[model samples]
Target: MPHSLLAVPPSRGGVVPALLAEGREVTGSHLRELAARLAPPMDAVAAYHFGWIDQHGDPSAGDAGKAVRPALALLSARAAGAAAEVAAPGAVAVELVHNFSLLHDDLMDGDTTRRHRPTAWTVHGPSQAILTGDALLTLAVDVLTRVPEPEIARRATARLSSATRGLIDGQAQDLSFEARVSVGVEECLAMEGRKTGDLLGCSAAIGAVLAGADEPTADRLHTFGHDLGLAFQAVDDLLGIWGAEERTGKPRWSDLRRRKKSLPVAAALERDCPAARRLADLYAEPEPPEGETEDRLAHLAELVEEAGGRSWTEDKARALYRSALGALDGVDMPFGVREEFTAFAAFVIGRDN
Candidate 1:
């Protein structure tokens, strides 16, 4: 079996950790400053959501996510021969958008925990969390509009807005998929491409836009990010089924519990094998799986794997990773930056959390 298909233990050291370390060092303070610019209540809510503060609004440090979007923005800028600082606003904008999505997603998905901490909706109430998400969405546009160069700001803002719209559409599709008994594998892939890929693609392109790179170069970078984002989502779907609860900060078999039509589940459903038929029967049960016992959820996960979902998703992820790297072919990027980007791609496939 491919390593990514197995229930491998989380990696302690890898490109993700290294990039996250550099990302925190480079963009951490800037992101906090931006978050602090919100109104008083919203600032506190945003701070807590960003893992910069405790529920009581006191200073506290937590996971704060992987900072992948910001890292991509900065790296894309550097790849375009511009200083990382030139893309700081773009990075901040992407981060705000990312957090905005997270806040809304937690509310929509009824998730109680994030990054091993109580989610914003759990701590601050749903209304406050919703308003804070709204604030973050607006703040993303505000950050882009304040960029010193008007043309660049305008381009970046449009790109971000378009991606945000796609993200919303994708979320809607995801919710709708749950109500249906059957969903096509292609449809699921497209939904994920938009839900996850759109933002990453925007993150990649915004840097080039800010740096005034040519259209072809910007398009190539967008393709790179889009493909990478699909691979990232595939890995995430795998983790949703098989990752350690401690590392993922979610219950074991959380995806199965929710009946989420993630890539693997969808692929398994599409198969005509006996295991797939059995899995379908389980999903067809009238009651939602939320109240299901761990044993039942474990069986559902096994059915998915027995139906070939795990290997299918793993192969798809690896293929997308290669396609992402291929998208960078002949693009003008610094050697060190290109090497780093390549390592990041590898890390996405092998990541445990």
Candidate 2:
């Protein structure tokens, strides 16, 4: 197992259920093998990014993050009546693509830390971080090419390529929204659906495709992951505004500080309340050189909550969660597998970090 799956102090809060832990272990083995092929410092940088080694090259695994994408891949194959190994290639590819996005995202967003540690882009140069992300993305396709059947490889490659395009489009939209004076909740939802939902849908369906599942079953699995991805992003937006810095591994009011028009912020902006108007005014003001705006980020957060954004976001997440679970109902799977999927979905919206 990746040392990341080991129990840590409750203070550094996160949840990695046994299912996710198993998936992480399988993905880890493949990741290590791929990283070893890179030349010199690049290998070490990749290792460090995955929490398998520290900056100085000492062994570690305290912060590799939950492998939710890979776990979905594994379960998806099983749900289609295949063994976990049938999903291994897809699982690794999904995990690599996820980390690729994270590396680039941190660089683009000016985020300095992730998983309670300095981000790869901050420690290494921005150029290296970009290179690493590019390499990982290439490797994601390479992983699929290793599958025995040529047709399976071709189909999986198409799935990943399509998802990557969605992720890119979503990221671009997210950046564009930051420049806009106002953002609609619907637009934000669409962007998030592309950014987070596309890959998750791929993760849930790719394995089934590899396992020879029929089109309808794979479609249902895709729906399950896609809706869950939206719920995941909703919870993430809540954390960006209100989560504890210690547990969430991000600054308090992180989204407000970045002027992110995330779900809550966009919903608040759509409201008719005075708080929403003031929030809009605050957003319209020039961004300070240091970005604190006289430390009004807290006020921005308060304004969002008062405008009913938080409640609206929370309710939306619950609804999305229900929709995700409902998508699984049409698929044929053992009762226990269904329950496992349910628990995992619950954990997505409920996790503290």
Number of the predicted model whose TM-score against the real structure is largest = 1
Task: RMSD for all candidates, in order, please.
Answer: 2.7, 5.0
Cα lDDT over the full model 1: 0.85
lDDT of 1 at 198: 92
TM-score of each: 0.94, 0.93
Give the lDDT of residue 127 in candidate 1. Answer: 89
Residues 27-123 of candidate 1 have per-residue lDDT tens digits of 7787788778888788888889988899887889788998888888888898899987788788888888989999999999988988998999999
Candidate 1 ranges beyond 4 A from true positions: 1-16, 288-290
Worst 10 residues of 1 by lDDT: 1-10
Error of 2 at 193 (Å): 0.4
**lDDT over C-alpha atoms for residue 83 of model 1:** 85
> How does each model score on lDDT?
0.85, 0.86
Which digits, one per residue and each the tens of the lDDT, describe model 2 over residues 1-353?
00011121121122237778888888988999998887767787788899988777889866898899999999888898898779999999999899999989999999987888888888877988888888888899999999999988888888889999999999999999888999999999999999999999999999898998887998899999999999999989998888888888887778888889999999999999899999999889887777585358878888998998888888888888889989988799865678777778887887778
